[model samples]
Target chain A: AQTVTQSQPEMSVQEAETVTLSCTYDTSENNYYLFWYKQPPSRQMILVIRQEAYKQQNATENRFSVNFQKAAKSFSLKISDSQLGDTAMYFCAFMKGTGANSKLTFGKGITLSVRP
Target chain B: DVKVTQSSRYLVKRTGEKVFLECVQDMDHENMFWYRQDPGLGLRLIYFSYDVKMKEKGDIPEGYSVSREKKERFSLILESASTNQTSMYLCASRRWYEQYFGPGTRLTVT
Candidate 1:
């Protein structure tokens, strides 16, 4: 069984500042997918960003990006110029296969607070 | 653009009651999942359905069961609700990479 771990239980950052959330996983599969999901107070889980283990270039989506180190089993999410809307619980998820049938393993989560 | 809807936003039931939490997806997705979220525990998959009428037990299926008579609808059932079963239940549907989620149903068993 693969496990995703987010060591931080809570994190806070000033608005417009940069913040990084750390995540690590245990998996034997070489080709895999990683994701960062945000759950706001409304409780809807939204996809923030994703990374493919095979890609060394890292993934960038606007101000959201990932530092994926497959060799170290680490996948971290970095949010730049953080805003108030970014306050939410962030989850790190792992997937080993493609398509709808693939199962996802998620970390406990880190609650991020963006202070004004 | 993708929509996943749950039957209720909040539900309170008595212990030993047969509890049903319904979920419906609009994308006609082939895969549906039920997960329970708790404080500091993240989300634990209860069940997943890949096709109509086909169900698979996930990590935490001991006190839960699932039904999927149609491709768009997946239901989670608690045979006998217990106090320990109180938590927020989230439903999701996916066609390939991204999973679209519903506004979860918060269920409480007294």
Candidate 2:
């Protein structure tokens, strides 16, 4: 079974500043994918960024990027130029790369507070 | 844009009542999943369907059941609702590994 862990329960960042949220996972499978999903006050889960285990280069999506270290089993999300809209609960997820990949295993989640 | 829609944004039901939560995806995703979210605990999968009429039990499926009569819709059911079941329920559609989630339904079991 694959499990994702987000050590930080809560974090705060000043607007326009950068913040990094840590995530680690345990999986015996070699091929997998990591993801970060944000749930704002509206409770809509939005995909932030995703990284494939096979990709050596990290994934970047404008303001959101991931520091994916496959050897260390670490996938951290970095948010640059953070804004107030970034204040939300962020979840780290893990999924195996297979046709039978059942569902995503999520971390406990971290509450990010973007202070003005 | 891919959209996953849940039937209700908020619902309140009594104990021992049968609760049904419906989810539909606009995109023709092959896989659909149901998950429950609680404070501190992230999203835990309850059930999932790969194709129409095909289902699988996820991490926590004891008190839950599911239906997939159509390709785009998936339903999560609670045989007997309990106070512990009061939480936010989410639905998702998947193509490969990455999935698109719905707005979620806040279910309150009294």
Candidate 3:
């Protein structure tokens, strides 16, 4: 079984500033994938970014990026130039690299409020 | 772009009542999933289907059942709704590793 942990329950960031949401996971699988999802007030959860365990380089999607330390089993999301639109509940998820039956295990999630 | 749609945005039901939550996807994705979201719990998977007539229990499948008679539609059912079942229900369809989600249904069981 796999478990994801996001210790922070809530965070606040100033607009145009940067913020990092920390996440860690416990998994025995060697090959897997990590993801960050954002759910805004609209209640639509969208994928922010993704990182593969085999890749050394982190994933970046515009203002969103991740610091993936595979050895430490830590994946943190960094939001640069945070905006009001970034205010949402963010979740970290893990999935095995192989097998069609593989499912995602998600962290408790952190509520981020970007204040203007 | 993939689009997933839930039958309702909000619903209220009484205890012991049978509840049905419908989900439909426009894209021809092979896999669909049902998840429940609660405060501080993020999202917990209830059930998933890889194909028509094939269903798999997820992490939290207790008190929940799913039906996938068609490729684009998946339904979640509560045999007898309880107060604890009041939460947000999310429906998603997978395209490879990426899963696209619907707006979600806020179910309140009283």
Candidate 4:
């Protein structure tokens, strides 16, 4: 079984600044996928970014980027130039690369508030 | 773009009542999933289906059942609603590794 951990329960960032949300997971599988999802006040959950365990390079999507350390099993999301729109609950998820019906194991999310 | 839609945005049901939550995806993804979101628990998978008439139990499948008669529709059923079941329900469809989510249903069981 795989388990994801997000130690921080809440975070606050000033606008135009940078913030990093930390996440870690315990998994025995060699090949897997990591993801960051954001759920705003509207309750619509959207994908922020994703990283593959086999890839050495991190994944970056515009203002969102990920620091994926495969050996350490740490995947943290960095939000550069944070805006008020970035205020939301962020979750970290893990999925194994193998298996046909693989499902996600999510961490207890961290609520991020961006102050103007 | 992938679009996943749920039947309701907010629902209030009495205890012991049978509850049905519907989900539909337009992206034609082979895998669909049902998950529950609590304040601190992020999201926990309840059930998933890879194809029509095929269902698999997730981490928290107890007290819940699912039906997938069609390729794009998946339904989550609560046999007897309880107060503990009062939480946000999310429906998602997967394309390869990325899963697209719907605007979740906030279910309140009284």
Candidate 1 structure quality by residue, lDDT tens digits, B9-54: 9999999999999999999889899999999999999999889998
For model 3, the docking class works out as medium
Please provide, for model 2 over A3-46, each residue's C-alpha lDDT reduced to its tens digit, 9 standing for 90 to 100.
89999999999999999999999999988888999999876899
Best of the candidates, DockQ = 2
Candidate 2, superposed: residue stretches over 4 Å from native = none
lDDT digits (tens) for residues A1-116 of candidate 3: 99999999999999999999999999998889999999998779999999989999999999999999988999999999999999999999998963557778899999999999
Evaluate residue A22 in candidate 1 and report its C-alpha lDDT on the 0 to 100 scale. Answer: 99
| Clashes found in each candidate (C-alpha, N, C closer than 3 A) | 0, 0, 0, 0
TM-score of chain A of 2: 0.96
What is the lDDT, from 0 to 100, of the residue B35 in candidate 2? Answer: 92
- Residue pairs clashing in model 2 are none
Task: State the lDDT of candidate 2 residue by residue for B25-101, as single tens digits.
Answer: 98899999999999988898899999999999998998999999999999999999999999999999999776999
| Comparing 1 and 3 on DockQ, the stronger one | 1
Q: What is the TM-score of each candidate against the true structure?
A: 0.98, 0.97, 0.98, 0.98
Per residue, candidate 3 scores C-alpha lDDT tens digits across B1-110 of 78899999999999999999999999998889999999988899999998898999998999999999999999999999999999999999986788899999999999
* Model 2 lDDT, residue A57, Cα: 93
Superposition TM-score, candidate 2 onto the true structure: 0.97
Better of 1 and 2 by lDDT: 1
Question: What is candidate 1's lDDT per residue for A1-116, written digit by digit as tens?
Answer: 79999999999999999999999999999888899999999778999998988788999999999998888999999999999999999999998877556878999999999999
C-alpha DockQ for predicted model 1: 0.76
